[model samples]
Target: MTTSTYHGIYAVVSRIPRGKVATYGQVALLANLPGRARLVGYALSALTDPSVPCHRVINAKGEISRRNGGSEADEVQRHRLEVEGVFFDSHGRIPLELFRWRLYADE
Candidate 1:
């Protein structure tokens, strides 16, 4: 049987809006699985569905984490985010304060 954690991770990640980002830790927290940021990263890397927009998920540092196997995937993630109108600083990090998606229960 698939664990709730697996479903929770994908559901939370899917809620991140276009033009905004969420950290892996934030995703886990939102999914009610605190201290499971690494698991969030693993779930994202295993995703193959473009509809999920896994690239919208970033690290806590606001830097794009290298997806599983290669640097090329990193570039692709950056490009995907850029196309969605997210901006990165010269240090190659998204300004989380501005672009981080705020998921509220009432919204």
Candidate 2:
């Protein structure tokens, strides 16, 4: 993807509301980049915007990706989620059935 596309994905991810979570696939799809979930991850991994809340994204299975090279990134994500009152199960996966964002039909 081009730099513009990456910026577009970042914009979409930035719009995700607090206390809600979007999957990597969801952000990609929302940005009109189907099947580019990993691209979304890549974009977010490079994120520097404090307002973006990039940590609110995870895998489709509701598990935060451990792509930052260690458990430290995962711990940081979990800590952020906890700060937002997002409870995780014993397996460290968010219960998407309960906390997943319900995007509007027109969104």
Q: Give, for candidate 1, the lowest lDDT window spanning 10 residues.
A: 98-107
- For candidate 2, the TM-score is 0.89
- In order, the Cα lDDT scores of the candidates are 0.84, 0.85
Candidate 2 residue-wise lDDT, 31-99, digit = tens? 999998988888887877777789999999999888635658788888998899888999988999888
**Poorly placed runs, candidate 2 (over 4 Å):** 105-107
Candidate 1 versus the native: TM-score? 0.88
Our model 1 lands, by Cα RMSD against the true structure, at 2.1
Per-residue lDDT of model 1, residues 4-83, tens digit only: 77778888878788888899898889998899899888787677777787888889999988755666989988999999
Shift in Å, residue 5, candidate 2: 0.5
Whole-structure CA lDDT of model 2: 0.85
Task: Report the lDDT of model 1 for residue 32.
Answer: 88
